[model samples]
Target: MPVFSGIWVALVTPFNEGAIDFPALRRLARHLLDAGVSGLVACGTTGEAAALSKDEQLAVLDALLDEVPGDQLVMGVAGNNLTEVLAFQREVQRRPIAGVLVPAPYYIRPSQDGLLAWFGAIADASTVPVILYDIPYRTGVRLELDTLRQLARHPRVVAIKDCGGNPETTLALIADGELDVLTGEDGQIFNTLCMGGRGAIAASAHIHPQEFVRMADCIANGELAAARVIFQKLQPLIRLAFAEPNPAPVKSLLAMQGLIVDELRLPMQRSSPTLLQRLRAELA
Candidate 1:
C-alpha cells in the first residue's frame, strides 16, 4: 500500500513580494509535521502551485527534502501539460519526493479516452507512484469511476485524492475496494472516514491540524459522537475558507497567526472585507 494514508495537509506555499517564502514555509511545514500530519503535499492547489515558477517549484521540493524527515510522506503536485508534466517528472527523478499527485489536464476538458491516455503516459514515465487527483470542479474534467478503476490497476498508480465532495462517490469508491479514497474536502472528513475511506488530504488542516487528527482518532476509536461535535464546529470555518477563492482565506488565517505575510500572486487576490471579517471572527 502507498504511505499516503491518514491526515496529509495540502500545504500552503508561503509567499512574500510575490515570491516563494522559504522561511515561512519551513516553519509551517515543521509546525504541521509536529502537530501530527502524516504527510505534506508541497505544491498542491492549496500551495498555489499554478502561480509558482518552474524554478521555484524545484526549489520548494529541494527545501522540503532538506527540511522534512524521511519518514514523513512528501508529494509534489505536478499536474500540467503533458510536456510540462513529463519535464517536471524528469526534473524530480533524483529528488527524495514520495510521489507525484496529478489531475487530468485542466482548462482543456479532454475526453475520457484522452484523460486515460494522458495519465497512462505520465504513469509510464514516473519514477515513483502517481496519485490521481479528481477534482472536476477545478479540472473541468472528471476522471470517472471506471477510468479510475482502470488507472488503479497500473503498478505505478496508487491512491486518489477525491475532491468530488459527494458521499455517494465516496461510498462507491470505498465499496469498490480496489482503490484507496482520501477525502479532499475538509467539511467531509468525519463523514468520509465514517464511510470507511482511508483519510483526507485536507487543506483546512493547515489551520486545525489537531481537529482533523481528532476526527480520525474518534472514528478509529469508534467515537462518532465526539467526532460529530468537532465536525460541526469546523464546518463554518470550512465554509469561510472556501467563501472566496482558496488560499485567500487560508493565507489570511495564517497571517493572523503571524506565520507568514498574506501575499498572493496575480489573478488571485485577498479575500473581500466581508469574508475577511468572518474569517477573523472564526480565528478569534
Candidate 2:
C-alpha cells in the first residue's frame, strides 16, 4: 500500500455562472501540485460533493487527474445509497487513483456491524486501497474504535480520514499503528501530526498550500519549533476558511486571488459580507 503522508488538499470545486468551471478547476489542481501538496482529494466534503451531480463529480475528478499523477489523487465516494455508491466505486477504481475516501452511509446511521459490512463490501469490490472517512458529524454515525480496529485488519483498507472528533480515538488509532490516521480537521493538523498522524486532507490548504506542506515536513523532520510557528501563523487563516459553511469561505478567499469565481450552488450560498471582509484583511 502507498503511504499517504504529508499535506493532501481536500480541494474545493470551482464554479462560474452556476456551472462547473473546468478551466479554473484544472488551474487550481496545478497550483496546488506546484505548491507541493503531497496529494489531492477530489469531490470530498470540501468540494461540496453533496451538491454536485454525478456527471459533475466525475468531471471534477477527471480535471484533477489530468493535472495530478494517479498515485497522488484520491476521489471521495459518499452517499447513503449502497448500490449506487458501490457502482460509483467500481467506476472510480477503473482510474489509476491512489485510493477512494469512503464515508459512512449518511442519514442511515448504521450500527458497528453494519459499518463493518458496508466498508468491507466496498473494500472487497475496490481494486484500489480504501481510506475510511470517519466523520460522524456529517455522516451521523461514528466508526467506534473496535469497529475501526476490525476494519484495519482488512488488507485493502489502508488509512482513515480521522474526523471522529474524539481525541481518545485519535490517540488509540495512532498507538495501534494499524491504519494511517490522516487528520481531516484543518485546525487539528499540527497536533495530529505531532501525535504521529500520517498527514492531513486539509480544506484550509486551498490557500498558502506551501505553508501547510512545509509544516508537515517540519513535523516529520523533528523541527517542532518551526512547525509550531507555521501552525500558529496559519491558525487564523484556517479558522477563517471554515468560519462560514466550508467552501463558501474557502471559495471567497480563492476568488480574491482570482483563482475562481466566488460562486456556490443553491442551498449553499456565498460567504457573508462580514466574513469576506475578514478574509480580505487576513489575505492582506
Candidate 3:
C-alpha cells in the first residue's frame, strides 16, 4: 500500500482579518505531522474550500506544499464545477501536490449517472490521480456503490474518501475489489477496517492523530483489545468535533492550544460557548 494509507486529516484552514493565516496553518500542520498523521488534506469541506477564491486556494496549497514534508501525502480538495475544476487541475499541474480530493456537485445534486460523467471527465483531465470524496451530508448527493465501481474502472481515479456512514456500502465496494475505501467518518473507521476497508481520511485526526493512527495500526496488526481501548477514548472528542459545522469545533480546540486564531470565514462561525466549555471538559 502507498504511504497514503492510514489516517489523513482534512485540515482546517486558519484565518485572521480575512486573509489566510500562514503562521497558524504552518504550526498546525507541524503538530499534525508530529502526531503521526499519514497525510494532510488542504481545502476539503472542513477546510472551507468553497469559501476560498481560486488564487487563495492555490496560495493555501502552495504554503502547505512548502511547510509540510515532501514525504507526506498533500491532497487538495477539488470541488464540483467542471470548468473551474479543469482550470484548477491545469493550474496545479506544475505544483507539488500528491493527489486531488473531489466530491459530487452540492446544489445541483446530480444523478448517479451524472456524477459518473462529472468525475470521469475530471479524471481524464487530471494529471494526478483523483480520490473520490463521498460525503452526502455535505454534498446532497451520494455516489452509489454501483456508480463508484464503474468509476473505479477509470485509471486515474484511485481511492475513495467515504463518509457515506454505511459499512454495507463500504463492504460492497470492498467486494468489488477495485477501489480502496478510506473512511471519512471517524466513528466508522474500526468497523470499516474490520469489513476490509483500507483506512481513514478523518477530520478528527486533526487533534488526536497519534491515538487514531494507533487504533488503526492496532487493528491492522490484529491487536483488537488495544484498538478498542483507544477507540473508546476517541469517541468523546470525535462527537464534539462534529457536534457543529466542521472545523468550527476543531478550530476552537486548536485556538485553545494557541495554534491558530480560531477565526472562521463568514457562514462558518466559531463554536458556541456551550460547545467550547464541553470541548475543554471533554479534553480534560
Candidate 4:
C-alpha cells in the first residue's frame, strides 16, 4: 500500500509582490514537516495551482523538491486536457515524487468510462503512485463509487483524496480497503480516521498541523479520548479557515504568525477585515 497515511498539509502557496515567495514557502514547508505532518502536498487547491501558470507550477514543484524530501512530497496534477496534462505529468515525474494527486477532468465532466480512461492513462504512464482526487464541487464531476473501485485495480493507483461528500461511498471505500482513503475535507478528518480511513490532505491542517498530526497518531494508537480532545479544539479554526474563499483566512493567520506575506494573486483576495478579526480572536 502507498504511504499516504496521517495528516498531510494541503499547503498554501505564499505570494509576495505578485511573485512566489520562495523564502516563506521554504520556511513554511520546514515548519510543517517539523510539526510531524505525514507529508506535504504541493500545488493542490489550497496552494492555488489553478491560478498559477504551468511554468509557475513547475517552479513551485522544483522549489518544494529542493525543500522537501522527494519521498515525502506529492504534487497536484490537474487538467481537463489529456495530452497537455500528460506532458505536464511527464515534467513533474521527472523529479522523484511520492505520488501525483489527480482529479477527474474539470469543466469537461467526463463520464465514468471517460474517467476510467483518463485516470488509467495517467496511472499507466506514471512511474510514481497516483492518488485520485475526487472533488466534484471543483471538478463538476463526481467520481462514482464503481468507477473508483475499478480504478483501484490499477497497480499505480494507490490512494484517493476523497471530497466526494457521499458518506455511503466514503464508507464503501473504507470497507473495500482497496485504496488508502484520505479525506480532503478537514472536518471529516476525525470521522474518517475513526471509521478506519487512513488520513487527510487537509487545507486547514496548514494552520495547526501538529494538532492534526497528534490527532491521527492518537487515533492510530487507540487513544480515542485524546484524539477527540484535539479535534474539538480545532473545530473553530477549521470552521473559520473556509469562512471566506480558502487561503485568504489561512494566509491571514499565517501572516499574523509572520510565516508568509499576506498576499494572494488577483481574484483570490485577502480575507475580510471582519473575518480577520474573528481569526485573531480565535488564534488569541
* lDDT tens digits, residue span 1-284, model 2: 33688899998898888899999999999999999999999999889999998888988888788889999999999988889998888888878899999999999989999999999999999888899999999889999999999999998899999999999999999999989999999999999999999999999999999999999999999999999999999999999998988889999999999999999887888999899899999999
Query: What number of backbone clashes does candidate 4 have, counting pairs of residues 3 or more apart or in separate chains?
Result: 0
Looking at model 3, residue 261 earns an lDDT score of 90
* Per-model root-mean-square deviation over C-alphas: 1.6, 0.9, 1.5, 0.8
In order, what lDDT does every prediction score? 0.82, 0.92, 0.83, 0.93
TM, every model: 0.95, 0.98, 0.95, 0.98
lDDT at 161, model 3: 89
What clash count does candidate 2 reach?
Answer: 0
At residue 129, give the lDDT of candidate 2: 83
**In candidate 3, how many Å is residue 131 off?**
0.5
Off by over 4 Å in 1: none
Flag the better candidate by lDDT, 2 or 3. Answer: 2
Once model 3 is optimally superposed onto the true structure by TM-score, how far is the C-alpha of residue 282 displaced, in angstroms? 1.8
State the displacement of the C-alpha of residue 50, model 4, in Å, after optimal TM-score superposition.
1.1
What is the per-residue lDDT of model 3 for residues 1-284, given as tens digits with 9 covering 90 to 100?
A: 54247888889999998899998888888889888887888888888887998899888888887778654645565666788778877887668667888888788899998998899998898877788989898789998888998999998888898888767788888788677788888888888877778888888887778999899899989998899899988999999999999889988888887888988988998999999999898767
Positional deviation of 135 in candidate 2, in angstroms?
0.9
- TM-score result, candidate 3: 0.95
Q: Ranking by lDDT, best first?
A: 4, 2, 3, 1
Question: Residue 88 deviation, candidate 2, in Å?
Answer: 0.7
